[model samples]
Target: MRTRAKLSLSLTVVAMVLGFMVTLQYRQTLLARVSDVTASYTDGRQKELADKVAQLERVNKDALKRLQNLNGEIAAYEKESAGADAQLTSIQQNLSRYRILAGTTPVEGPGISVTLMDGQYNGVGSVSDYTTHDWEVNYVINELFTAGAEAVSINNYRVVANSGIFCIGPVITVNNHRLVAPFQIQAIGDPAVLKGALEMQGGILDLLRNVEDIKVSAVKVEQNIQMPAFTAAVTAPPSEGAAQSTKSSEGKQG
Candidate 1:
């Protein structure tokens, strides 16, 4: 009986130890499973964050491309605007020069003034031979132009491209305005050149003083001479299309 009791006690101790070992192994396995689940959840969260970062990078690249394209368009527009401004400036300059040449605006510069007077001689000669004529005035004007005169005026009346000069009996008519003796012709040009040209051998001055016996005196070189604008109505030459239209209207009226 004693021996059997001893063996039973030993078998009871072994069975308790085996049960404790089994319980410890089961708890360890449960902890390992929980750790695996936690690790899997963290990996999933990291993957989600990485995917969002990749998507943002793609969006940023697309935005950058669009911005670059907008910049290119803006640059091209600026270049075109600059070109248009330059063209407009050039056109304005050309128009200003044309207006100056047209003599529609008043001009002031250095030039010379010529005064022609009828002879005061009381000799036996016709009155017409001693007095100034329209031809003499025209000749002086022509000479001034040939001597590189920029502007010319007779008795303060601006002479233009279409100006007319004729004689009305004892009076000289320039631009339809009557001018009497002691004609003052103001010309804008190099004073020396103008004086030299008029005083040259057998020039207009000589013809008036010697041949016609008219008194041509006093060529004053002035530093500043102001010329008025041509007040006469400027008639523009009709264009071909306008002339044709006018003819057509006349035909219809007829």
Candidate 2:
């Protein structure tokens, strides 16, 4: 009886071990099948993405080629246009310069140039000239323009553009540059019209001529003066994008 019981227990243990082994092998097969399906799906997606990338690259290449062609066409057009207008522009510019250099242009209209200098002072009751510093010069420039001079310059430097009527010590500043006495002021406008607008008629010019008097000359010169170049002028386009960015380009190109 004892032997039979031991034999039964041994058989039960073997059956249980075999059942667990089969269950583990089935589980492994299921995992392998799932892995194969997942890998196939991933490979399909990767291939699709690669094809899409290839299409986009082709499109970008085509766009760049078109841009280059358009740029070449534009260059040809500008060359032809510049050739057409070159002679006219040059002729006009030469004429303007010739007029200026001839001194036919008037230095002033009807404005006064009051000069102030650092020299011997006239005593009390003695009506003499010569007052120094930046204030006097600035006062005269402003007054001249206010009195109807279209433009004013100290020496050759234009005081109208980014120039200050400031002073350092005895010298006056015109466009940050120092200028000494006997400053030549050039203006272009109606001389007679400006002369009537002066605050102290003969006072400014007369002071330079007589009292504390320095040499200050004001005469109306006919204005054939040429205007200066503007800092921001229209410029040529830089790149394909630049041409495409403008309204004019769109209208013309479209």
Candidate 3:
């Protein structure tokens, strides 16, 4: 029973990760297409880009279909195992924990939200200085996680283990999804603790306000905050060395 339960959980996690990775890849492809669509592109180039986008759309659709099938299969297995009350409950509890860790589950609870915006420009030395940087956003996220934030989001984009925050011109991309100021960061955790972490003296708020010159608003504690599951891939791309090692291992097995 233990072995079967572990196997089922492992398979489900693999399926969820693959689905997210496929979605993330599709989003990245779209971002690339957007970047490629410059005024300098010729008619032929535009047509080629359109073709690639269409192909990717089909791929994304197929991946979603597969994920749906996998979910159905898992559901059927759960139904079959429901007869074992004690074992089933234990399995379910473990599954729920893993789902949260994998970020495949949406979470809602009492938490806090912090809003950051660009400071007012007074013919400033550099506009960037008054704006929020990706690192600053990440700093807040890191702080939240350090303070026991179970889940976090920025402008409704779920921040998972593998989520990246980087600047693209005036915008920041999370999970390859672009967002602009003011960025509202919401986290699911203890309201007071999360709020205190951000509002503490010389904390994230102080650094953003005094050093970064960002418009840092008061952290609002809420009784209920909803954060969506990470829809993009949680797995980081394997390094070249790791890929080569896997290939060598496969060769040895063969």
Query: Model-by-model lDDT, in order?
Result: 0.73, 0.50, 0.75
Model 2 CA deviation exceeding 4 Å by range: 1-133, 161-163, 167-177, 196-202, 227-254
User: In candidate 3, what are the lDDT values of residues 34-139, reduced to their tens digit?
Assistant: 7665633557878788789899979976875676577557757766776569888788657767877777656788899989887864433454542345678878
Per-residue error for 148 in candidate 2, Å, reads 2.7
**What TM-score do all the candidates reach, one by one?**
0.51, 0.33, 0.59
Candidate 2 has a TM-score of: 0.33
Instruction: In angstroms, give how far residue 54 of model 2 lies from its true place.
Output: 60
Over 18-65, each residue of candidate 1 has an lDDT whose tens digit, in order, gives 999999999998887768646665787777987898999799668656
Per lDDT, the best of the predicted structures is 3
Best by TM-score: 3
- CA deviation > 4 Å runs, candidate 1: 1-90, 120-132, 167-177, 236-254
TM-score of 3: 0.59
Better of 1 and 2 by TM-score: 1
User: Which portions of model 3 miss their true places by more than 4 Å?
Assistant: 1-84, 120-132, 165-177, 236-242, 245-254
lDDT of 3 at 71: 59
| Least accurate 10 contiguous residues by lDDT in model 2 | 227-236
lDDT rank order: 3, 1, 2
Q: lDDT for model 3, please.
A: 0.75
- Give the count of colliding residue pairs in each prediction: 0, 9, 0
Superior by TM-score: candidate 1 or candidate 3: 3
